[model samples]
Target: MAMSKQQRAAVVAILVAGLLGGAAILFTGKGGGSGEAGHEHGEHAEQGEHVDHDDHDHGHAHDKPAATPASAAAAAAAPAQAADQPHVIKLTPEQVQQAGIGIATAGSAPLRGSVDFPGEIRFNDDRTAHVVPRVAGVAQAVPANLGEQVARGQVLAVIASTALAEQRSELLAAQRREALARATYAREKTLWQEKISAEQDYQQARTALEEAQIAVQNARQKLVAIGAAESAGKDGKDGKGGSLNQFALRAPFDGIIVEKHLSLGEAVKEDASVFTISDLSSVWAEFVVSARDLDQVRVGETVRIRSTASESQAEGKVSYVGALLGEQTRTAKARVTLANPGMAWRPGLFVTVSVLGAATQVPVTVAADAVQQVDGSSAVFVAVPGGFAVQPVKTGRSGGKLVEITEGLQAGARYAAANSFILKSELGKASAGHEH
Candidate 1:
């Protein structure tokens, strides 16, 4: 290239200007690089993490809505105060009365007396009787109907027996002989006293009288053995007539006829039961007790018997109690005699028998309703000034409506007698608030 003096100066000036511009660009790039590297080094030192500026700004924009300082502080304090709020219940005094809630003071009180037992009504064995045929005979007629009440010696049925007929015949013959013997003895005595007959003749007549008397006695015995009664004459005197076979049976006791086995014209054995009579004036309450209850029962102890079938309640004394438990049920039998005055207690009716024995007094007791169950443990709601609080309780033997409080609750503390559920709910609400 050809250069003039002016061209060389201009070209040289253009080259110097280009060199200054390049140095300025190099310095600006170095300063920018240094700034980025410094930021990376600081982030790594502070957080032990490599920093990417583009990603940092992207995440910062996404989290901006959730970073309110006021909301964070409020959320942190919400749970702390929730547990302190009291649970409120709106209930009037009348509602409490209707719900049966009140304080029951713990003190000595008699436990309710209740005993659950199972028994069946039965007739008094000693007062019952079975009608049996005294001799083999045919049942002529049964006058007594089922459940018909009869008195002792009342005719219940009729029976025909050949043996009875024969016995009556013998009794009639003997009566005639006795009359003849009495007449002969009277004549013999008169003759001897008057000296109008030979002494030997009078003696023979007396001997004949003695023989006739013996025969009469034997005949009377024979008649009695065959259920034959000597007939009374029309004038209510002795009429020694031969009697026919009996056509009626008599009741042996005062009772209601419960069963009749024979029918009209039916042949019956000498010992066959013709009628079953039950005296309902007194009944038996029989109870079966377990072996463990033996000590609680005694022969003279009083017992209460109740039947759901009737309104009659009876008190009875233990008449008998089996000493040994049954081999099958491991239970002993106990019997009580109850006076079924109106025969309200029927045989086979179910009855609840409660045998009362000696009472053991407990030192302290509380109403059963005051106790509640919490988490498998018994608890009581103790009435405080503001509300009811739960008090864990330990209970011993229970009697009726009262239970022995051994622990957790004191003897003098007042507790919610009833409607404890409402109090429990109030306490739960307070606890929830306190937990907050």
Candidate 2:
């Protein structure tokens, strides 16, 4: 297979060119395949990224609906729980007895319409007195003490009065002169009858006797005006050692001595008040009525007086009502006279006067004690399955033993009529525990 040099060279050149062309084609095909594969892989990666983003958005959308139902379920369950767990107080039968709890059914009843006014107990002015010394004197002895019960004409105190003494002295002197005059008149008459003396002399003696008798009478009247006791002496003279200065201050009527100003050996004036006595067997309940209610508080109207300090009540009639209104309060004064047999009604005690009006029927009425306060509203405790539940109410007129329920209560409902405050206390304790 030896050939010439030119032919061999030509063949080698052709072979080298062919080999170079094949290498170029193979390199171009491999480069094109790698570029196409890289482009396809990039497209797939972008598409996968878009698909992952869509799945994340879809998951968020599903989560929103799911969360709504959970919240709705929780809200729905809240009301059911509230319905089951109302404010309740459980008590056994023994506990109820120990607590003195009582229950009664609410029903229709008639309530008396009434108007209440604040009042106070005061002394009956008709039976009160202020004792004064009639003459200037020194208090020798004080026999009546403050708060001592005294009878009419009872000696309250003894006073040594010079003015009274002078009056008595003048009476005694005049009486002596009167006795002498009487004797002289009798003697003059006998002389004139017997002709033992001149008629002119007898007449003069008679005139003198008459003048002396008038003077004695005048002096006796002066003593009587001064409240001086009648003398025991034969000639209208004091027999007890002429102690005319001793003046006894006596009570004017049966009463209790409420005040005393005179003390032993103290000088008092002629018009000085020495004692204050009051007959406390009865008292006046004085009340202030507004101008709007003045027409209702007429004299002679019957009223019920209840004490605010204690559970005491009395009945009386209106004795007085002031015609004029007070300037400061714009109210009129009214009073009721009540008999105080045991003296239990003391002055200065606060009271309420209830004047009854017409009565009216109410749909639902409960005992006054059954009403209690809950959450700043009037409420009544109603019997329930487990215990008692508080029922808020609106109240209207109240009188005697019943109160009208305007709302929040129904007829024939059983409720705690007595000792209802126990339930209130128990409910308050439970509420406090939950808060803590």
Measured by lDDT, the strongest candidate is 2
Assess candidate 2 and give its TM-score to the true structure: 0.71
lDDT of 1 by residue, 205-311 (tens): 88887887787788777755544465522111122332277635678788899988988789998788889998899988898988777877789887878787775
lDDT on C-alpha atoms for all candidate structures: 0.75, 0.85
For model 1, what is the C-alpha lDDT against the true structure? 0.75
After superposition, candidate 2 runs with Cα above 4 Å error: 1-86, 170-228, 231-242, 326-330
Per-residue lDDT for 333 in model 2?
90
